[model samples]
Target: MQVSREEILHIADLADLNIEEEKIDKYLLNLQDILNFANIVNKQDVSNLEITIGSNEAKNVFRKDEVKVFENTESLLENAPKKEQNMFKIPKVIN
Candidate 1:
């Protein structure tokens, strides 16, 4: 599960990354560590375990949709630096 110097160089070339000669060893070590972790995960014993989507037993906790009008219009618009027709106005981005 170890990453080689050549593999690191190849990856850099594929990604169009300009990895310095000094940093090649560091990159190789980090890549090797990631592969080692993957190897460890692959060796896990999950034969007796069930394939579960989630661990939580609770169902959806969503509330009913409701629309309510704001009572205090003046208070809500008071903080706006640029207000236009009861709405906050922003500078036009696209032509």
Candidate 2:
């Protein structure tokens, strides 16, 4: 699966990329290396390998949820630059 320079230029054109003249060879080599790797992987035999979804036996594992109350209020807001009504305040983000 040899990639030509013209095909690389065509791909750049389709992607709307401004590839410099000197960088064309670099792009061509990188693309060719990727295609070569893909071809190598495609030629491998994986018929004996088992199809497994996960490495662990656990499925949908979740911890118990509980509310925790902090006794320190002044210490929590001590480092905040802008604190309002016992909370960190920020400028309106959604326009």
Candidate 3:
């Protein structure tokens, strides 16, 4: 598609762009090239190809769910600066 100088100016105005008069020709040529490439891409054939969302042989390899218990509570709260009723305590954060 051939883009006219007036059309380029109108596009620039609609996009709120400050395009110089000398740069308009360059922008027009670039836009034409992009459109031509898009037209070429639109003519591609992908009829036999399958649409895959992720990697080809991907599976969720997760560990089995298991229950574990800790034997020490005092050792876990040793490094805490404040402790109350077997739990760590801190200053109020929200008003």
Candidate 4:
């Protein structure tokens, strides 16, 4: 579509912009190109493509939680700086 210089200036004025006199022609041509590309995209045929809500159709993909006993409890707590009841004894955080 052809964009006029007056229309460009009017849009700029509405947007509270102060466009330079020399750049109006450049802006007019750029706006016209963008509108022409949009028209081309609007006229495309997409009847055979599947409609997607997002990039993929993945849902909740998590493994079931199960408790298991460790064989070597002494080795796991060997490097603990403080151990009281067969476990790593950390400083009490909450009052």
* Candidate 3 clashes between residue pairs 3 or more apart in a chain or in different chains: none
TM-score of model 2 vs. true structure: 0.44
The CA lDDT of each predicted structure is 0.85, 0.89, 0.86, 0.86
What's the distance in Å from true for residue 11, model 2? 0.6
| Candidate 3 residue-wise lDDT, 1-71, digit = tens | 77888998998999999899889889999998888888875687877887777876667789979988888
lDDT digits (tens) for residues 1-95 of candidate 2: 99999999898999999799999999999999999888976687978987679888747978889888888888989889998988998999999
Error of 4 at 90 (Å): 58
- Which pairs clash inside model 4? none
Candidate 4 residues 20-65, lDDT tens each?
Answer: 9999888888898889888975677977877777787757678879
lDDT per residue for candidate 1 within 1-95, as digits (tens), equals: 66678888888899999899998888888888888878876788988987777788647889879998889989989999998988999999898
User: Residue 48 of model 1: what lDDT?
Assistant: 91
lDDT, candidate 3, at 82: 96
TM-score (all chains, Cα) for each model? 0.43, 0.44, 0.42, 0.44
Off by over 4 Å in 1: 44-95
Residue 39 lDDT in candidate 2: 92
